[model samples]
Target: MLVEYNYVIICSDRDFSLDLKFRLKKYEDLAFVSFAKDKTEGLFVILKHRPDIVFINLSKNAPEYFKMVVELRQYFHNLPIIIGISNDKQYVFKAIKNHFFDYWLLPYSEWDISKSLLHAKAQIPEKTEPKTLCLKSYRDFQYLNTDDILYLKSDNNTTCFTMKNSSEIIAYKTLKVFEKQLPEQFKRIHQSYILNTDCVSGINYGKNLCTIAFNNSQVPFSKSYIKNIDELKKKLAQSAIFANK
Candidate 1:
């Protein structure tokens, strides 16, 4: 997924600010830029927008610029700050020491800006993987952990998830849709039921029922699905043998 990074520019020069905004807008889909006339206004904009990256002009006023950096770092330590410097190489060492993301000498090129933006994006921490299933129903969505689900029962076009908490969640999607996305641990034991193999306690071959000891519930399997039961028993026996060894 492409992450659209929101950024803000802090500079007092109007003409330079407009030019920077124009240059940054060239990559509109990758970045969204906002502007602030000075450090005071920049702080407010930063607080409001919570931008992923920030660009500050350091050529005109170095002291005030670093002051803003100090203030920003107090609240947002990880924010990527790109410094705009003049041809004077003196500021480069300070920029490096301050841990700035990147610095561009005066007369910004499209390559330099693009490189800095890409570097800033790389500094952002990767998003954590989602552990729960998000099910949407009409106006809102519900989140349920994959481990919490004991089994699923299908009723016509709707599928209901029976959770460990003894509560059920009804989704509009079909059982086949869920079967495709669910982990391999979920097995189809019947046309109406999908059982979590991890939760299966025992099987009653005489009654053709699989018992879930987690919830003390029994689900029936069809004649066509009896092979699944045999497979389950074989797996259990293999597991038992392994444990003994």
Candidate 2:
């Protein structure tokens, strides 16, 4: 399927100015523009437009960049998806840690952008059918659809996939692996757990966590992943508003 979503581009340097915007235009459904030098303007555009993606260049001094990420997190929690451009491994790691969907090298290429779009599409769950994901291992592999999923938890080396049928499948997969395949609705709330955003009942902001009431049980949100949870909350709020309109 062809997915069309609005996008906001933030770039401080001018090296690839016109080139990037021209290339982005090839995606007929994407509405994108280039920001001259104002970081705040770029952020405002994201908050105002609520685009499907935010593509930004990572600065050398990243603590400040993180502050912006955190701020956007507060308002856009499930902010479409963020793609950071940076060559430094440290900055790329930090962006992912902050919940950015993907990070690419400074010079943008069609292949890289295409890959990111595919990843984003995979993250957006479709309502037509329950999503099916396959679990692979040295001995045996299995496939489970979304309808069968109750929740997922990670423990050191292994991850547990709980099903609605009261069965659990323990597999060798990292939180990151499942994250890419799962829809945007599923968010990581703990270092060891991932919960569907729709499954969340309420958040205990004062305690720096939230609880997901799933299938007669409650799952705790880890403090480390609270930022991501809250961001998704914002996205949910915006969605509600749009529906009301």
Best by TM-score: 1
For all predicted structures, in order, the TM-scores are 0.51, 0.46
**Tens digits of per-residue lDDT for model 2 on 20-108?**
67777877867674353446776777777877777777754456656777888788647678787776666876887889898877566
Q: What would the per-residue lDDT of candidate 1 be over residues 1-245, giving only the tens digit for each residue?
A: 35577778788887887787777777764565578878788888887888777777887776777777778778875766555556566688777777777778877677877787777677777654345888987889898888888999999999999998999999999999998878666888899999887788878888989899787889898888788778888877776644331
Quote the RMSD, in angstroms, for model 1: 10.4
Off by over 4 Å in 1: 128-245
Provide the lowest-lDDT 10-residue window in model 2: 236-245
Deviation from truth (RMSD, Å), model 2: 17.8
In model 2, what lDDT does residue 129 have? 32
**Best-matching candidate per lDDT:** 1
Please list the residue runs of candidate 2 whose C-alpha ends up more than 4 Å from where it truly belongs after superposition. 1-3, 33-36, 125-245
